[model samples]
Target: MTDNISAYKFDWPPITVEGYKKAENKVIMVFNLDVRTPAKVDHVIQYVVGRTVWCSLNSPVNVNILLSFDFRGQGIIVTKTQSLKSELLRLLNKANINNQVSIDFLI
Candidate 1:
């Protein structure tokens, strides 16, 4: 095993992913409407919880979350290269959930 130790030395981006699927029957929703450092950190947990809920809705199939900051309220954007983009768009429209959803934090 010592011979393979060097394999772990490669430089990797700090990017990390945390969440799971099918933890609950209902889908949850949360997000950071803003990209600022302070705001992003402030709401990350709930936002991710919401994301997990969203992803888990498609259980039995593996799903990933792709989040980014948008200057415009463009809602969630799945990778363009993925075939699921169109399907997700239809789902959002059918639900009548607008591009911008509000986030409320309670003390």
Candidate 2:
């Protein structure tokens, strides 16, 4: 068992995939967005809530206690090698979710 473990030790690169299904050239990616605080301007942050939130304005007082706000978003991306995966990647990375964005891929 110990010898076999050492033999199986390997790191897979981002461009490499294993156990992929035949005739399937695409892959699925999941994006998780979590926003803890509202945006500085009211109509700026419109992804999940899709509307101008009143608590977007920063104040000395804690907005959580003074007012209620919705801040969080999630979505999935699916595409093949021929499609524009870079566009989807740009959107996922550009989302201003207060450093609460994540992406996962399955092979």
Candidate 3:
């Protein structure tokens, strides 16, 4: 599991939900940064373990997802925020992400 995370090229910056909404368009999925190595990816996933969730006034409406990781593996991991919507949340939980990290929903 630790090997699956990614590290940022620069210092890990805080991704504010407010800032994401203001900056991006209607699309909610954004890969803010990418990692070039597996070790770096593991570092990122490990760092996200304790990160808190931020939401806007939209609540269960609009969502912003940030998938900051290194593409070391093959298939899609679905790290972005919007993909974790209520419906997707249930699916992920069923897929066994409940013990992974605290998921956040943005408005």
TM-score of each: 0.25, 0.19, 0.28
Error of 2 at 71 (Å): 28
Q: CA lDDT, every prediction?
A: 0.35, 0.25, 0.36
Task: Give the clashing residue pairs of candidate 3, or none.
Answer: 5-41, 5-42, 6-40, 6-41, 6-42, 6-44, 7-40, 65-81
lDDT of 2 by residue, 12-81 (tens): 2232112222344222222233422333221222331221011112211221211112223322224421
Please tell me which predicted candidate would have the highest TM-score against the true structure: 3
lDDT tens readout by residue for model 3, 34-100: 4345565444344443232222222234444443332344343455334323333443344343222
**lDDT (10s digit) by residue, model 1, range 1-107:** 12222322334333233333355322223333553343443354334333433444443343433333332443333342132223333434444443332222211
Q: How close is candidate 3 to the true structure, as a TM-score?
A: 0.28
Q: Which stretches of candidate 2 lie over 4 Å from their true place?
A: 1-85
Indicate the residue-level lDDT of 84 in model 2: 24
Q: Output the lDDT of residue 75, model 3.
A: 41
Task: Name the weakest run of 10 consecutive residues (lDDT summed) in model 3.
Answer: 50-59
Off by over 4 Å in 3: 1-15, 18-31, 52-107
